[model samples]
Target: MDEIQLTAAAEGMPNFNRRKALAVTGSGLAATIAAMVAPRNAAAAVVVNEAPVTRVNNLAWALARAMDDWMVDLGVDGVPDIWKAHVYPYSQRKHPVAFESLDRSPSPSARVAELEAAFHAEWAALRAIEPALNAAELRYMEIKGSRPVMGEMTPEEADRLRSTTVADLAKLPPNRASVEHAEAMRAYNKADAAARRKTGYGKLDRAYMKATHRTSDVANALLRHPAMTLEDLASKVRVHRVWEYDGEDFNFIMDDIARVAGKAGAS
Candidate 1:
């Protein structure tokens, strides 16, 4: 994408940008906090010592390596440009780990197994939350869209209906029926919004936003593969049941990624 589009995309990703900023500025603070909160009991210390930072490090390393292998399998040369442009910047912002950190870590095989287990756990959680996330998204669309729900119409159409009288209804033609329906729908939506405010819809909105951002991150990362087209990436997401709750938005994200990738390729 061009500079303008890139800027817009970055602006849209408020959570990602906020996290990036925190990662860059709060690394020291995070370390300090971790140290301060660390358990001092002998038994707790033993458990902590046995927790194996090396294993965690190795798992991270293996995940990265696996990504590299995937890139190679796709016949891409060097690292993905999107990784350099996006993911790597975020990672470096989050933690200034050295290239040799992976080499220094231990338990490579066990770490890989741990990674697989974590993936399964996360997948399970994602499935459990899918229905709620989907419902939240539907409600969010109702509050935000021109057509709040099925059979609803635009505000413009509603205005047209409001301007027409019952005496003029017959002369207003068949299209006016839609306008009348729209007016009724608008009233219904207005009442719905007021009711939603009292019932705490903001929490659901927040949840939907979080889920969208998380799904977008994964979608963008997958789209970075050189051989992956938008359709291919979207199919993979569907097959994996990733972002099943927000299929339409995820498809839009894939399109955005494809646009960026195309621009990058052309330049």
Candidate 2:
């Protein structure tokens, strides 16, 4: 739906989708929110005109995304009590009594109490299933950004590195530290040194590049700074791909991630 239509539907007004919609269970409410959380965006394409844009534009976009997330959290399909107050008592749809009675002439202290209670009850229920909710959110992001649904560091690489480093350390003479400990220390040193060498760098760099081509970093980068430009994101490092990074695009993404990570650290 268009943004205007989506907004209208969210405001308790009926829309085409609502006409065709089926009654959803409370159990599936979280999934329904997750499905609607992600805003529709066009595919990655270079803007040829490259008009001058201000930082405000980025902030605005970020706020828009945040609102979308908020809407999802409040049960887009079910409607949270907070919104229901303003929705119900005026239509066939249900509304929170607190909202409907907001302008009541008598002291509203009683209505306020009821509103608070209902709010807490809903909030508690949400918190109870928050972990699953978060997982669903991550899955939605990955799907939206065309990123890898599952990622991992390979055990084979870890084992091979361990073995090679251990072999190198075995030649070291023992000191006050036990032979086993000394050998382990040497192995670790060897591993660290090897990782600093060209091969290790190449492996990490290549993986970042490959992941970028698939927009695997999109979900991560956008989540942090929704306003990131295509060029701005071209410069970061990633190490979560089957193949190593070797292309110009990969190099850029790696640099971007590295720069952002550094800034985050300093901050």
Candidate 3:
């Protein structure tokens, strides 16, 4: 029995092997095994380390990615004419209802009202989940903040420093606010700031996720409606037109929804 250990690293995280044994007994076994195994191991490592690719599950997400790619390819200021020339053609071919015939759809005011109602419903659901979300956020902040700064100190070194600092602070004069006391206060404040910043960022991320999920839900629901054309759906949840100007691009609106629901089964 020959036991092989396979490992890979992705973003500093280790990947453990599932299969442990490959049995072989033949001439030139060592050479054969090495030839077969090295490339496989290397490929596995690369796959594990790579970031997840964005998937387009529906027409909406596909349109968004296409528009984004078009903008990147242009590499200059995005004027309406250029957008019509380069980007709109692709969208027209892919989703004609939304792009080729915008003027024949429902009024923007009517669509906005429907979208607002859906948004309000999702907002209520979010409020219901707020307490649990807040608790999880607090836990993340505590764990992140307490993580000892790496490189200069190990866990053991950090433990030693914390123990010594506490003892030293305890030996100071009880009544007098000495320099040591001030230093300790500053250290505490620094740690608190780090925790607060981390927590704030995490909160923002959660809020964004909540908003995205809500938007995705609304967009998906509208898309699924059998009677509505793509333009009708876009008008309801996207394509915000005001007076003579198109207030928001179709790509921007769809991209926002797609970011949250691009992958299949992302509700």
Most TM-score-accurate candidate: 1
Candidate 1 residue runs with Cα over 4 Å from true position: 1-176, 223-267
| Tens-digit lDDT string for candidate 1 (1-267) | 011101001111111122222344445644533332342223345656555677456646655765464334322244231221122333444322211111121222332323322332333333334334333434554565354334554577677778999998778544545667778798878876765554446565565456546545544444333323433343344324432334455565566577658977997
Residues 113-200 of candidate 2 have per-residue lDDT tens digits of 3332343333223233333333343444343322122233357645544566665766644332244555666666565445434234
**Residue-level lDDT for 180 in candidate 1:** 72
Q: Could you tell which candidate, 2 or 3, scores higher by lDDT?
A: 3
Q: lDDT per residue, candidate 3, 74-142, as tens digits?
A: 222432212221122333443222212112223333444355345434433443343333444444544
Q: Name the candidate, 1 or 2, with the larger TM-score value.
A: 1
List, in order, the clash count of every candidate structure: 0, 18, 0
Best by lDDT: 1
Candidate order by TM-score, highest to lowest? 1, 3, 2
Look at candidate 3 and tell me the lDDT of residue 112.
42
* TM-score winner, 1 or 3: 1
Give the deviation of candidate 3 from the true structure as CA RMSD: 21.9
Alpha carbon lDDT at 88, candidate 2: 27
Judge candidate 3 against the unseen true structure and give its global Cα lDDT, from 0 to 1.
0.39
Task: Give me the displacement of residue 239 in model 1, in angstroms.
Answer: 11
Listed in order, each prediction's TM-score against the native is 0.26, 0.17, 0.22
Candidate 2 segments exceeding 4 Å error = 1-34, 40-104, 108-267
